[model samples]
Target: MSGQAARNVLWIMCDQLRWDYLSCYGHPRLRTPNIDRLAAEGVRFDNAFVQGPVCGPSRMSYYTGRYVTSHGAVWNFVPMSVGEMTLGDYLRPLGVRVAVAGKTHIEADRTGMQRLGIDPASAAGVLAAEGGFEPYDRDDGIWPPGFSDESHRYTQYLRKQGYGGANPWHDHANSALGASGEILSGWNMRYAGLPARVDEADAETPYMTRRAIEFIEQSGEQPWVLHLSYIKPHWPYVAPAPYHAMYSIDDVLAAKRVPRELENAHPVLQGFRQAEVSRNFSCDHVRETVVPTYMGLIKQVDDQLGVLFDYLRRSGRDQDTMVIFCSDHGDYLGDHYLGEKELFHDCVTKVPLIIRLPGAGARRGAVESRLVEAIDLVPTILDAMGADIPDHILEGRSLLPLLRGAQPAGWRPAVFSENNYAFRDFVREPLGRPADGCHTIMVRDHEWKYVHFEGLRPQLFNLRADPEEFDDLGADPAHAPIRERYQTMLFDWLRNRKIHPTVSHAAMTEWTRKEESAGIHIGRW
Candidate 1:
């Protein structure tokens, strides 16, 4: 480790936040000064993308530093395989205390734990149950009618704050008092403009930020990594007072769509277009009503970050703690005529990634336009901590070289992301595809983007010509060569995925061509 290397890491992650919405990323209306400050004092990546478009799969990739297929968590509510190693698994053994403050969207592998006879109360089992992080205060933030049980921490906290109801999360936190004195559910787009009943200080974002601050204060002098994950700027998009009224339809960006996208759309895309959220977002009124609140939620998140960053500075932890701010995935916000994130578009796939490395060895106020993925963060954190990266397990390269202002040789050319739409009603009813066959992969380089579906027609976009990706040329014969080349690249990527995580690359190298010397040779050599 270098003398000036950061001693701790504060990995702050927001859910469903777009890359372009931040002021640092050129948003004209919504100014995120705190996040912009981080970018000014650090490195802001222009082309960072997540491995999956949805919450569960995208967050799984971020936590484990592996692609969605590699981690075996293909969709929401799907538990990652028990054998997968996460950032906590890698860092805890190195004497770094790893903890999480908010949402991870990780479903526990209970069946695997039971099969292996792992006690749920044991330390090893606890770590495995929570996707390797020690949960200081974990809340996924999606509370439906019957889902919010007594054990839900956030609901309990809300109730303690004098908000009483069977489901306080739904009634108070994600709801608003309408003009007629009726409770307006945040789930309804019509009520998005209403301010939530909860106070701004007690909102989900502020509560999670407070929890993160508590974790940091409790950690003391120990070297640690805190995954301060926020659940807001996601669905149930109602912001508390002040923030809810901060912006209106005037500040909402125009929905990026055209008539050509609806014509002869891919079969899978057709299913998505028929979805309720997509149809709702396709309406001009719905976009005007809902997007303002979405913007407000993002602004609130930025303000809370300001609070968190100020605390770090006041506590003097800013000197040796690395601060990384990013989102799990981007929200569609009616982009390309789609709502919520499931398809591969720049609005859904690209995320804002800003890293403020500690001390003099780190680069400051730099912008890197290289194609980087969510999987790259685990190795980056390890590299920053001076820990050896296990190449056999982690499939991402460290960005430490880039942070130090040096270009690493053999950097990736094209970034990859995948999606599984089997869980959606659209995939089941409209597409009529089996669960296993609903997979899709996207590969993109500097000038071109290609989407390959399992049983559907491919999609090709010349990003240089149509940066908004309004036009598709997958069927055009002139672009056939480009599509074929990108398909080949995707195939190569899949074929070379590191499947054997149990053994090290160094061990395999030592055993190669020396198998006969170490053990019995195959075919009786």
Candidate 2:
């Protein structure tokens, strides 16, 4: 096994997480017993998705597998520049090592020397700025030097899971964890005043699974790859203590979304879908106050991913290890009325695709509906260690043939998701403003879903007769030729790909006033 490559390539990843709240995507209640035991030991992909439904263009489509408008990295710190190419610049020139821990946002913030779009070998020569977007109005050097950016970093990892204050990352949301960071154990929370946590053997999702089992017990021979990354179910949804009473937020369900999905749909889910249901996103007020706070942060990230896969199956190394758990996008808690999620819907572009290729060639517990994408996870993690996959910037196509169970040998007809919200005022620069930005181009494939809207109005769902897309067959009259054959398959998928910096016609009309630029403006999608 060591000769075939993967001496180590863990790769976890989460943040804003949501792929139907786990329990192996059935959700019914969202317990996520260590991602349902790594989807019962690996290979779970029921139509995975995420290439920018938010969060730095889906981490620049898994470090450049392309599409986010031909990878200009379109918005959110716009980095990933300087001669793009990374899977950590292709596995640190092959000897591999790599590393990467939690939330590595693609690009933003650059000090003089001009050349911004990042990727000057994705830094580590000591570069800072890791999450919790600062305040007192962020942006002069984006978030560091923080005096206050008005909470968030799960409101300082949930007031450091209420373990007394002393700086639960600078306290304040009514400041009071009296003790001092370190109690928060697991499973507790019915609600009311709610404050008793600190125990899941001292949180921070098992302190980054004890630094990924001490980086695989200090990788002493080399050939590693790590990439941990796990911000957790996302949001102030605290956890620790029986995964904050493991799922009981009024029984949890919600997330369906079809009800006419707001007429003239898909201009990025038109006005963020919401026609009938309200009451601040019902379902018993997001299951008793926002899904018992996102299943108490996804049951403390399924008990630190079962303490790093039970310390890689009790150090036997579970067949030279090759686990993967995804999610860089997804979070639409109240669904339609919405909470967070740049809205592409599927509760924010699907997500949650497990993979664990160890012995007996993966798929042990099974479940793979296909359609995967997060830029096909760095070419199915360089073809699960057989490595060697390179054709330069591959736009994604190596799921190791659907983890070798065979399918998708030539798959993908509709596996794309885009975003460029007026590039979030250079991603929150001076707090940003210009608005009106919209540019979604979904394609769904099987079971009819066409969502095409550069400016607005163009949707045609039938996810098996409205799986909550309610019904906006664009302007039905008998679904006018299934909306012109998915608008010529979204215009031959943008005329056979290729875009970066190409948005021009007087700069797309000084920022989409479109009809071909009428004003001297300069902003919007």
Candidate 3:
């Protein structure tokens, strides 16, 4: 193994990309050669899971090296507390500049910032507002007709490209041209089979790839971390011509579901099952039409990644840069009779994680089965760059040691995920639960997956026996001991979570030592 330090980190994140969609992870049809190349040259983690299933909370966990519970940004559009320290805040002090090229899904803590006397337009305030990243170009990638904002860089770029409309994103980029030249908006799932009007080069994936390349070319010799986040393979599932027609219904895999799952579903699960997205996806025609388009979007992203990887090797950046490929969370794609994520199923909670360490390492091409979480990435990046991971603030363990061919002592036995569904209509209307009582926690170990919902019946699955999670033993009296064991584990995990971010373990130790030396222990006397 080479002793050379990593000079830069290329953190590539894809939105709503399932772990099983890529060929590297054994997708039978959707071949992702570039990502497969990464897996072949690096370590592939088979048991990685997100701390949250939604974009905002999951990404917050990734950026801050903390759980969703710790950050308190439990759902989308929910602002994290202003005092939360992120990867950029930790890395910048160590001379590693952090920048983002695409969507972060981070909403600013405006009130918190204002109360702290920070002007929103100021540089310090901007960094705080963007979840501690220097935004090269930030776009969340969903722009419907009435919801379109012309101020968005992508929208402006589309307008410049002769996509004349009030909302170019919805008109051209996300829409298709019919036989009579009428516009077919991608907002409707029925139109998902049509090719987008925009060219492949001008699409969102390629646009973000170009931005990433520009940032890399402009970063002259400075050690940096560039988060090239791609908002693709998400909703409004439309791809450009070549990619759009790449796959057909035959290429789409069978949806993993069963009639048994619907027989006696848990109350919270029933609430999610009642969602429009879930209901629509449950139809055979919907899955048959939409899934192929979803595959096309994923194929487009893989092609763009091929372009990006080629640029890295050509520029000689591959020699000294660590390239990490991962997603925030997986999309259900009609799995488990669900469409979008926001559940504890493996299809939604588990995600793809491949880390290509710079130079050489002993563990190349290895497959790690240990339970890892999204929060571990920041610590891993900090570890690679020789920076201190603040123990009080960052709770996740670094994966650098594992990359170096050794396992860390006391590795966690299970991974945890959480969700706050109070914002959804199903929770409020159908479930009749209070907003504050809509919280749910999932604990998944080697054999059993346990979910504890607030004021609702628990859900349990024996992964060893029922790997597909079709059987629910939550109400079975025979599984009482297993549920109790996992419940205790969850309680212990919550009790040990780091709450005081301002106080470090080292600082507390030093304070105790000083007090002992000064003979200031009032209780001892």
In order of appearance, the predictions have TM-scores of: 0.97, 0.33, 0.97
- The C-alpha RMSD of each candidate to the native structure, in angstroms, is 1.7, 23.5, 1.9
For each candidate, how many residue pairs have backbone atoms clashing (under 3 Å)? 0, 38, 0
Q: Residues 1-525, candidate 3, lDDT per residue (tens digit)?
A: 123358899999999999999998999999899999999888999999999999999999999999988999999999999999999999887777799988899999999999999999999999999999998788887556677776688888888888887677888888898899889988788888888999989999999999899999999888889999988888888888888888888998899999989998887777787889899999988988898888899888888889999999999999989999999999888888888999999998999999999775546788999999999999998888888878888889989988888857899999999999899976566878889998999999889999999887789999999999999899999999999999999999999889999988888879978888898886873
The list of candidate 2 runs beyond 4 A from truth reads 1-12, 15-197, 227-231, 234-238, 241-284, 291-329, 337-347, 350-373, 380-387, 390-414, 417-482, 485-525
Query: For model 1, what is the alpha-carbon lDDT of residue 13?
Result: 95
Task: Quote the lDDT for 290 in model 3.
Answer: 90
- Evaluation by lDDT, superior candidate among 1 and 2: 1
Q: Per-residue lDDT for 363 in model 2?
A: 59
For each candidate, what is the lDDT? 0.89, 0.61, 0.89
List where candidate 3 sits over 4 angstroms from the true fold: 1-4, 515-525
Clashing pairs in 1: none
User: What is the lDDT, from 0 to 100, of the residue 490 in candidate 2?
Assistant: 75
lDDT per residue for candidate 1 within 399-469, as digits (tens), equals 88888899778889999999988788666667677888889999988899999998787999999999999
